[model samples]
Target: MNRKTLVLPAAAVLLAPLLAACGGAEDGRAIVVGTTDQFIANEDAPAPLDPAFAYDTGTWNILRQTVQTLLHVPRGGGEPVPEAAQSCGFSDKASESYRCKLRSGLTFADGTPVTAEDVKYSIERVLKIKSDNGTAALLAGVDTVEAKGTDEVVFHLKSPDATFPYKLSTPVAGILSKDKYPADKLRDGFDVDGSGPYTMKVEREGEKAARFVFTRNPNYKGDIAPRNEKVELRAFADAGAMGKALESDDIDMMARSLSQKQIRELTETPKERIRVTEVPGLEIRYLGFNTKAPSVKEKAVRQAMAAVVDRGALVNGVYGPTAEPLYSLIPSSITGHATPFYDAYGDSDTARAAKILKDAGVSTPVKVTLNYTTDHYGAETAQEFEALKKQLVASGLFDATTRGAEWSTFRPAQKRGDYAVYGLGWFPDYPDPDNYIAPFLDSDNFLNTPYVNKVVRDQLIPRSRRQADRTAASPVYAQIQKIVAEDVPVLPLWQGKQYVAARDDLTGVEYALNTSSDLLLWELGRGTA
Candidate 1:
């Protein structure tokens, strides 16, 4: 099993100013934001809003900012603060159960009371739809979710889950209205009814690249302290177009998916016009290999494949200084970040890669389909894939084909492991390194790679989960990354240094520590001072 260190929360303010350059919202002005996505998928429908099921950071960020949770990871980087639940802590350590007493007078957008029954239903829904959504795996070892009344809900776990409340802090844990929901269908694209600072004004369906919109809920009196009354999510298909729109004041801000060259130009532009915040990012991009594939069952072949990736080149040519080459699945900013793969197989050596394949009795060239996403990540994604293809071909051990889909199409395909080898980037749903390891390494997870380390699956992850406090779980996650370095089921590519460009006049933007993708809208307000 892996050994991770205790989780030490840090201040998220360091890189939050990146979104401040758009020069708007100084005094109660509405914040009009521009994002890489062209559409906003229904945050509440049958889709995965639960943190355990939802892996995309951007989605989680938007959802969390808009919804009410029982508990929350605190802002400005400290300990977790309570929300829907007024009082929460380990109710019983022996059984690994967590208990919480809900806050009074908290109601949904419709002025309906958020009761314990709704909380129970939300927890049950994660496990019930786990097969396709898979986020329920976050609670796999949990036993039952029992609520005492409208004011108290207790999580009874099969094992210890110290970070359980953080799980509750996710969109997945957003309490659903017992009236609108039924027991049968928990499909994606269902209209969401959440208790948060904002409500869906105009949210598009499957075509999230089409139209996604939200505004502050007049009834919302939750943790999210939104600065503006209305926030518009303007979608641009291309980063180039998005940047131009920002320059022309057509959009107030641009997110991290902009091209590297574009970021440079934006950053180098007069600071008075733009602002940049380089939060030591922890978005870890990786190449997932389906170990279940008959051909990929060979460990030697996997090792050879890991060897040929030139991570340094990827950062220099594709991402520039705003990014860093990653050898470990966990980034350095996180507590247990380690470069296990780099320790084992650092650089491309075609001769060695070829020998490893040959020693495994593989004389025929291996064929693997590589997948990429064009819309979700950034413009350089295609270039990164082409670089990978050339590097692998140069190794002479394999021939590869590259394919890509828009974010809407690529995500489902990536989760299903439909492609032989696909590139996926994880912006953590929460801060801890365990969040990174557990989601990807868990045997029952979406990748379904069939790459099991009994020690990890059965021991370490459980060990980390049961610890009630953050400090207790660290050692387990650290060891998990170390062991992962040796197995290399997925190759770590680069850690995205999060950058947001905003008008210099905008203020109060908050960021999460490392890869924990929490954007506290409450902390953002006009600069009245």
Candidate 2:
């Protein structure tokens, strides 16, 4: 996932512009939602809303509501259930082949018939384009996606993967109209031609999405029944403006972009009209090292940095009670969670960091630049990076500097190895331990870092995936986390707590988010408090 920038809390004047952007509220028929997620478009990522190139949480939030995948993770959360497909499962005991039969009478937003060919084409286009930041790597196990007849789609995997079904549930596998989307290129413009529960009309400001108006899809053929007839998602400059809109009754609900201070204030001083719901989230923030960079190329340099960093202080000072220090790639709630980082570092000792540099014969006052986005994560991200710099500088072994850039430029620069280290936040594509670790460690990792481990990437991950029972893969995952701690390619910082604040009259705020934290706008509607 990409991180946004931090700005000082907004003044009351910031509220006026956001309120004007609401375009006059509906007569209690449409639910106006507020967020600070700005989707950036550039040459590398010309279409931020297209599934083929879209990977960030903000883009995925819009895609999930408008696009239909073959299967979907239920609101309450559990095993995958068919959405576009009438039925789907592994066809063989090896889990190398899977089949799905499409539901009849399905139609895209443009009213084109949905077919198995669309599924095959959609999956193939993602692999064909293979955009650098796209999710093609997630489907790397697939050898071929075949359309057998008009209703049946088959996936032939190169290896056994029990998580194949779960992968299909994500927007990466969202079905698209073959006629609308080019086979070798990403579809441009803000228009969506999906067969999901809701059809969207986007209002754009330059390259970013300003507002999205979603109406129930009359052509939809799925299990979801949208509780609200219409819903409008409005983007803000920062969380402070979003909070103000929520307070002034300009929007019915606020999505997951609230600042740490905003969450505390809302929780501590409960508003009569507003209600806050806190859920355990899979969101995690970490610092990724560019292993090829001169400042941190040596293993000793990375290890020493990790040893000196304090995650506890990061939580207490920056994130407050809204987050907890995370020591492993997988959060504690996951099945194979381990504390390898804690095991190696043992709670930030300056002496240990010094010994690491001394033992390796590295020079003191190591110089490195830390880069973070200026507009994506939250208002406190800058504070978080500054705190990190202070900790590193205080170690007496390193000189650290922090840099900020808007996400549009920051993401591509990180891919080009512009900084020694950069910050990133991950919202899982699916709620699995593999989703947490694979994207960072796999050969085609999301981070363009040069670090690669053959054992973790080629051996352990495959071994773990072959097991149908997730619990059976626990030991293998534990070994993977241990290798991460030893290598220090990425440093786990903290796991976030999800807070969704909405008008008390809203009925489904508690159920609007899936396990991976994707907002399900269909679940929201007006009701008695």
Candidate 3:
């Protein structure tokens, strides 16, 4: 599962926005998409569409259409190409200084011309707000941004970071109008202003966006063209309902949130009118340890838990074939991925786990409370945790208890270190090894754990970042993964595979997902075949 979204019956809500798009659907110029992705649209911190705070893939899917970035990953995943910018690259060989030339005649959704100052303001505002729920830490390397002129922008980095452009390709660096958004505060609304391929109008039901209606933006001037005139994204409570909507012809596509059973039915049975496409995904689920916590404070205790986990059994039993066992923070699909955990502790060995505890002078049946978010990670998550609890307890060397909360409360509590151990998922902000390793191990890490290794934080990551060629950084990343395995700051669980189920008549369903797993709705349209 990518993220959260509220569910509503497809036929029940005939809202005006949806009705308008429905009229165009008859002509094959309009398409309806269903997803289980969700976001919070409240006054306090985040409001879904705010570029600074819209960090999840669900929100990014909507933003990718309406909010334009300087660069963008191409259809079906590849190197990023210019979107709002005509050209962008590092100005120096060290990958420390980067520059971009914006495409001329660019205009925001509000009809205001987009200038370099707006780009500068957009990047700076994200850094200034620095919301914990946001991806501000991705811009940690940036020292300052300068608007050289109306069409040119330069970024001066605190250090060398070859992955910076990939970060820019994400919605984290989405260009917004300076006049439309405040410099120091998150824009507190579902409305958005950008120069992407579509103009979006959000229909709200309380704090949730019930539906997102996107009309083709006539003023959008970029590398890609919209294949359809309109797209309506319908929110489903669960994958079951979303699948039903696709089967009943209520929606043309179901993306990012399909359950394993739904995927199996779509792929195995071969629905004549429907088809499913599977792509390699960068999404991963893991367990984070509050290293200062009493129970897991000892390195041996954490290592014991890691050695006892049977990733193969957990993935196959709970997730079917939809997910694969993951040993490293970086997925095998990403370059520089190494299996240090497997190298250190191979498979489930209760004797090995017991010995680890005994060597550390720790007693048997060490009580540990495991926490997880109930609502966000799909229906199977509860089963996954239950399976995990059984595994730990079955080892006869530990006592494990499971606790869960809704995402709204769970995330804040995890950040506060309320739980000794918690499970969380990561979908890449961009498709790179740095996106996997840096976020957890960096100085101001997203995990907020007390575990710190100066060598990994200060030396290995920075050394890897300096290489312009990502492949050249492989050995450094290998060392970093080994350190993570040894320390057990966070235990890697499983890596996911992306799937999208759409009507067989859809033309561009195969190319709708980009390199970073962000949905590009502009690629979808009715097919002649």
- The whole-model lDDT of each prediction reads 0.68, 0.85, 0.84
RMSD of each: 5.5, 6.8, 6.2
How many collisions between residues are there in candidate 2?
Answer: 6
TM-score of each: 0.88, 0.94, 0.93
Q: For residues 1-529, could you state the per-residue lDDT of candidate 1 as single tens digits?
A: 1111123234433434343332235455556667675444443223544343565656665666566788777654545678777888876746477888877888898999888888888778767766554566666766888989668888887776666766777677777775755544553552456888777654554535343456678877555455566566666678888778777776656664667887676566644456655544568788888777665668777778888878888788888887888888778887767677777786776676777788889765787778898777888889999989888877777787799987767767666657668888887757777777877788667566667888999899878766656666777777887778767788888887766666554455324223454555444434421
Give the candidate number with the greatest lDDT: 2
List where candidate 2 sits over 4 angstroms from the true fold.
1-28
Which stretches of model 3 miss by more than 4 angstroms?
Answer: 1-29, 43-45
CA lDDT for candidate 1: 0.68
**TM-score top scorer:** 2
User: How many clashes in each structure?
Assistant: 43, 6, 6
Report the alpha-carbon TM-score of model 2 versus the true structure. 0.94
Tens-digit per-residue lDDT, 240-321, candidate 2: 9999898899998898678888788777788778887775578889999989888998888988988888999889999888
Superposed by TM-score, candidate 1 places the C-alpha of residue 374 at a distance from the truth, in angstroms, of: 1.6
Span of 10 residues, lowest total lDDT, candidate 3: 1-10
Q: What is the lDDT of residue 388 in candidate 3?
A: 92
